[model samples]
Target: MPVAECGRPASPLIVVLSGPGGAGKGTIARMLVEADGSLRLSRSWTSRERRADDPDDAYVFVDRAAFEVRRADDGFIEWNLFLGCYYGTPVPDPADDRVLLLEIDVAGGRQVLDRHADALCVFVDAPSDAELYRRLVGRGDGADRAA
Candidate 1:
């Protein structure tokens, strides 16, 4: 509720885009950031191995130990362990001065909501289970993991 000298809200609006795997959350997040000059996507950190097809900037890749160390230091706004890998959204830099966009899962969204009650949360879902599986496999995820 803080106000800036320019008469705007001091804190950037927090937007949480969450969904199950293969639900197009990443694509939508990218589109939203691209279309809005005042919005910035906060890249997430992950301990999982980067896939060959993944964009270089998709995540701030790190080893599990490093991820744990950051978690211990309270560097993440929300962090979660999924399928034996760790993923987290880092706390926004105060100087960024833009609306913050978070692309994460439901659990992470819940954590963010617990801390920032006013965050705008959007849940994306695939049109059908079969299509979700197809998207997952097409994206290089193993069938077992996709399921």
Candidate 2:
């Protein structure tokens, strides 16, 4: 069943930010929230290999069992297993009356659109493949030529 927006299912501003792996979704989300106080970035929970310097404040890192428990309890707006890891958005407090920005992948974006047809989906794109590769490699992950 598609998850409906709390109360106002007709027109809720569910902003979806999606792009290639190296595209700057996190940066954009931060900027949007900083610029507009009414924008809320939904913090995601993950059960994945964490990066060494990733600010622990970024995501709620958990083991697979814990994540599954949350999912079973319907604590997530959307959850999925990706690339051998789990990732999900926690249910936002709808009473906040803010634009909820969900930084998700193409598949997750589709799920949000399916649930809320009125959602504003924004596809963030890189200037070029070279630029994306450069950014990815610069981030300390050895970029592949095919990337």
Q: Which candidate wins on lDDT? A: 1
Cα error, candidate 2, residue 18 (Å): 1.2
Superposed Cα deviation of residue 12, candidate 2 (Å): 4.7
TM-score per candidate, chains pooled: 0.93, 0.82
Candidate 2 residue-wise lDDT at 84: 77
Sliding window of 10 residues with minimal summed lDDT for model 2? 1-10
lDDT of 1 by residue, 42-136 (tens): 99999999999999999999999999999999999999999999999999999888888999999999999998887889999999999999999
lDDT values of the candidates?
0.90, 0.79
Cα lDDT of model 2 by residue, 8-77, tens digit? 4444478899876668898998888877775788889999867886887788999999999999998987
Q: Could you tally the backbone clashes for each prediction?
A: 0, 0
Error of 2 at 138 (Å): 2.7
